[model samples]
Target: MQVISITDLNSVVNPTRLAVPIDTEQQHFQLAMKQTCMKLPTEPLLDAHPQIDRWIMEVGLLFPKVFEWEPPQFLVDTQFIAKLCTKKKDTCVQINTNAVFHRNGYVNLIEWAIRHPVLNWSDKVKLWVATEYLSLPPENLKLTILALHPTHPGKRYEISWDSQQHEETRNWLVSVVTKQATPMKTPVASQVKSPFPVTTGADFDIGKIEEIEI
Candidate 1:
């Protein structure tokens, strides 16, 4: 949640400290540098909506070098920062610019949605009926933004498409969204006590066992 600015790189990485000699005692320093230089993994989106995926890809291509498909990181965590003062070439411009562009774009979209009220539906049944009949291709599906109601902060805007569709398609989309929102529960293993305890060394009585005919 911390918005790390480009100028705040010093807070995450100290150039003077990394300049220290890499001896046996400074192994941790080496490990830290390795981790900092490693590529960050990207997180899966809430839903696998085709349109949304395409939109994200398009945004990334706008600044191909900056907006990579990997997880966003603080300026200091980038490889560019690690190579900043070193003999390595500085390649931090793309990431920094990409981060700013991504953050600002989302902020602007949210603000615009809050200010404009294109459609309002008070009836829940009507909204459901509308959504059930709606049909739109990935390309035609306009960028629909949802925000908390201005007066009623607790409630959110109900998004619906303007076209009609079959009941099957409506149910499928609903199921997809529902499944994505729900968190998966992992089963926990319980510990059980053994019925018998065995003795070791001299206490181990193999002679006490009686031979039985099978």
Candidate 2:
């Protein structure tokens, strides 16, 4: 609920300390991010929708990047941020720009981006804003961002760019956002009593044996 603009914070905080809190925020944003976005390992859209994942994979292979797929990134995240802040279909260049920087960790980079005279209030500078709010490992986090209609949209980038896919992606992201597991708490040794006996030697096996089969 405490959504801080990525660029506004960088002005006051140290870059190093800012990193963790921002990362923590991104972890928080995942709920919102995954909710309205689509990715590979993408889930069922109404369980009856056609297979978008396979389509994205196939489209990815066609790309020049020998890596097999362009791989879903925060392009979708920034786009949504643009939507969240602006109810209007048209996005602000600064807001989008800030979202990009915010998605990525360019705490220092934002000041430079805004100075670009070409940036328009209506333009929506998505590239810069997203840069500040980057979250790592969700790719391996068993989620994927893929297109909605494979044939019509063709690929993730193309689909993401489509104005029509915006709501669909947002709807999908919002649904799964809560499903991603919370960061697991590490179990403390003292918190969990070992079944093993505290005293060794003669009584070594007794405490640990909660139940005896014989």
**Pick by lDDT: which candidate is best?**
2
**Model 2, span 1-214: residue lDDT tens:** 3233435322212122223223322232233323323333324432333343343344344332222222232233333242233222322212432122222422211111101112221222232222212332112111112212212332222101223333333332222222112232542334323222222112122224332111
Badly placed stretches (over 4 Å) of model 2 are 1-47, 62-124, 130-214
The TM-scores of all predictions, comma-separated, are 0.16, 0.21
- Candidate 2: residue 2 Cα off by (Å): 14
lDDT tens readout by residue for model 1, 1-214 = 1222222222122222223332331233223322322443222331422333343343233323323333443222221111111122222211111111133222001101121223321111122322222222312222222221223221123233334422333332233233323353531111111121211112223234333221
Worst 10 residues of 1 by lDDT: 107-116
How much lDDT does each candidate structure score? 0.25, 0.26
User: For each candidate, C-alpha RMSD in Å?
Assistant: 27.1, 22.0
Highest TM-score, which number? 2
